[model samples]
Target chain A: MTPKVFYISDGTAITAEIFGHAVLSQFPIEFEALTIPFIDAIEKAEKVKQQINDCFITTQVRPIVFHSIVNAEIRDIIFASEALDYDFLNTFVSPLEQQLGVKAQPVINRTHGKAKESYENRIDAINYTLDNDDGQTMKNMDKADIILLGVSRCGKTPSSLYLSMQFGIKAANYPFTEDDMDNLKLPSELKKNKSKLFGLTIDPQRLHEIRQSRLENSRYSSLRQCRIEVKEVEMLFKKEKIPFVNATNHSVEEIAAKILDKTGLKRHMF
Target chain B: MTPKVFYISDGTAITAEIFGHAVLSQFPIEFEALTIPFIDAIEKAEKVKQQINDCFITTQVRPIVFHSIVNAEIRDIIFASEALDYDFLNTFVSPLEQQLGVKAQPVINRTHGKAKESYENRIDAINYTLDNDDGQTMKNMDKADIILLGVSRCGKTPSSLYLSMQFGIKAANYPFTEDDMDNLKLPSELKKNKSKLFGLTIDPQRLHEIRQSRLENSRYSSLRQCRIEVKEVEMLFKKEKIPFVNATNHSVEEIAAKILDKTGLKRHMF
Candidate 1:
């Protein structure tokens, strides 16, 4: 039986799904998530109990996620965390409450967690954008104001997916395949759309770390191969006039900002 | 001199990009969004001041988002409408927040009057999933253990995208094209993948309101077409024994829950 997680949010299922998916990703264990939204205090607690029972009935020991922007009283009813009463939305929402059709309340007890969100969900967008895609996305290359090109471990997929999912901008990235690297030129299709092109490069060491799990210890997965690929791709980006960024030692946040800054194209895509 | 919106998030530029793009879609209004991340007391204010000098900053009308865990004195120095002195992470993050490392703060003084975010942003994943996508994303199907099929405005897109984006599931949705509708059969792709199929349908009147903006007063845009398309497609779903839900007034929360209830397909990609 899979573990059970529940998302209890006020407004939409997206909030729950957003939290649910993220929590599940951090652990290797199998889990099942159920979302209960537009739920109030009474229903939220009841659902948690019910879901827990349901999971126990099925999976025996239910591992779970309860994600929400809920209130103190409600949080206490469901989870035993001391930070349940602590919340963050009160200040920003004061003005928009009337328009959003919700009331406001003040509750304090929680402090800022040591770190901020890493947006691991965007990785979902990345995988989907790469795996679920066909020729149609690549067809609109000219309309894309920014295009990312790089090898598999260069971080092109995550960056491009973030741009499209977050900004609504039609962004597309093409891989710098071995064929392109050997030929020492961008794909003819990408070369034609060179004005919007950008590239990403990473330290060969880090590149190997990212690829090792998937490829195993083959020659193609060697440090020497990574180094060679990095250099070839760098040369290719330069020859094609594609500005490139080195992602070693930089956090994803820092890397994305540098990329946004270098593109000089407006970064305003919702 | 585009209006400059500032994002003080700590994650990727994608956070700013999404917010920026969302704000941009409401244009005749032109604005450049300047993003500053990993902000604390001093630098946060500086970014706001710099933007004020360089561009017509909207929230400088005092925009701020912080948690209660931070000092109140800092809130005075920086402009946060809905400041959280508390932590945004709750053992887990919503995919959107986890990826971006930012959370929505309340707008205190709506004096500047930014429209509330559209239903689009909150559940953007769902919409992305339902976007017919013209078969651009076929390869990622393994990630999509569940795919949604429905007519226009049936809430299929938002639900599917939400599942995919939030869960890292490769979710795909196909609009039962006119050809499929006429034949009273599931599309060949879906028919071949029957075990993974899920369906969604919505009230015709609801569908009419949703489509009104894009089609305006055209005949195809009429309530009549909406009703017919809905009725015919629903019958088609029934004929093929496709499981579906009628997405009338239910919020995204309810819709997603109902889907989970009906399909029994798990969406956590990991």
Candidate 2:
């Protein structure tokens, strides 16, 4: 069954969605989620309440609301809505106030505010990923926190960008061309940075499917080529004593987490 | 005062960190956080317990633990640790199980699993952003979900990438160069798709600081140039009837959300 889930927040509502998804994933039910952002005023809150009530009346089911709304006046209107509300900010703030002996400061979207250093770091990391993508420029290799090495379509690009976007990691990804895989040797430019290299391997069949989707019926997407490339790349990683992960069944988030977990690389922002 | 925060998870610990940051932002207390990931095994759980105990001993106060660990045994161990734990997964899972009339699946790191279609969409969006960045490929303008327009360093690149990375929205960003700002006309390439255009403006002083960090003491980084470019871009946006947002003090997440809200663009996922 598809349950209606509303993620309401004074700002982005990303945090509510993250926690909501984590909790809701335990159940086998599917969710149709909606985000209501920038609801800092009472009028917006009243509109949201009307929407929630209308959804319940139309569907004959109370929608689930996951919110991080911090304004007490606005939050009161949402709390009065017809939904199973889970507002983490309000639920936890009061106890924290008593424990810390200080009143909670209800700033609208303060988490992403004033943290300019980390904000700039994330932006710089993304720019770095864009610039160093596919080994386009080796000039800034030294600036990379981690270098992802893999054959084409082995999930390097997405994983590299995910690392940068989520953790402020300067990730530079280089594709292992057919020539390098045939040589069974790390490229000279990457040889000096062996310690920074992390490899990614994938199932040949899966690789073929991904490649075929991009380049229909080409030799590059052929099963035989995929098998050979996967074998050689795995061999190369093993021969070079570089740690690697199989990305056939893993999401980009999972692959990135594994890389960071294994590498223990210090992030630009922690 | 600085209180220690621990984001522990059986997987990436990212969800814990995201929610932890959101909830903790309500309080004025400062936090020093450490992420302990991959604690699915009993031994790893024991190690985490010891670390938590050691941290408590060292700090003379209990740490605030935000976790998403699913394994019951491992969670039991963490629960036994000397910390004020907030395991939202378990806290909300039982109620969901009861409501759904099914036992909750206690899989480790399952939120990002088996969602291959959304994963592929995100990757494709990132690739699209890279290809169309800075008006590099106007050939594929029709495929863009949203086109970002702004003066240089108005945060088009990072905002575009964030939209792609998080929501799988194909975003193409173009910079308003000095010549284009002078003309105050939309580029011919973008004229046909004015409806998809969203503009970004920034504070001149902040823009000066950001540009000076990269290209120091240049006309591009000059305060006067920044002011003129911002004024021209705002005028252009108004004249064209294109929606815009000031990105001077906002984070990439905030800017992306505002864009999505303003555009009413349907995400490739959700």
Best by TM-score: 2
Q: Model 2 misses residue B237 by how many Å? A: 0.8
Q: Which lDDT value does model 2 have at B159?
A: 89
Candidate 2 chain A: worst-modelled 10 consecutive residues by lDDT: A91-100
Q: What is each candidate's DockQ, to 2 decimals?
A: 0.14, 0.66
Chain A TM-score for predicted structure 2:
0.94
Off by over 4 Å in 2: A98-102, B99-102
TM-score of each: 0.57, 0.96
Residue range A1-270, candidate 1, lDDT tens digits: 444556654434343444344333433344455665545566666666566566556655434544444454655555542111212233234443443244544222111110112122232233335442322355666656677777765766445554544433345777655555566666566778888888889998877866785588976678888888888988887776789889665533355566776676653322
- The DockQ-derived docking category for candidate 2 is medium
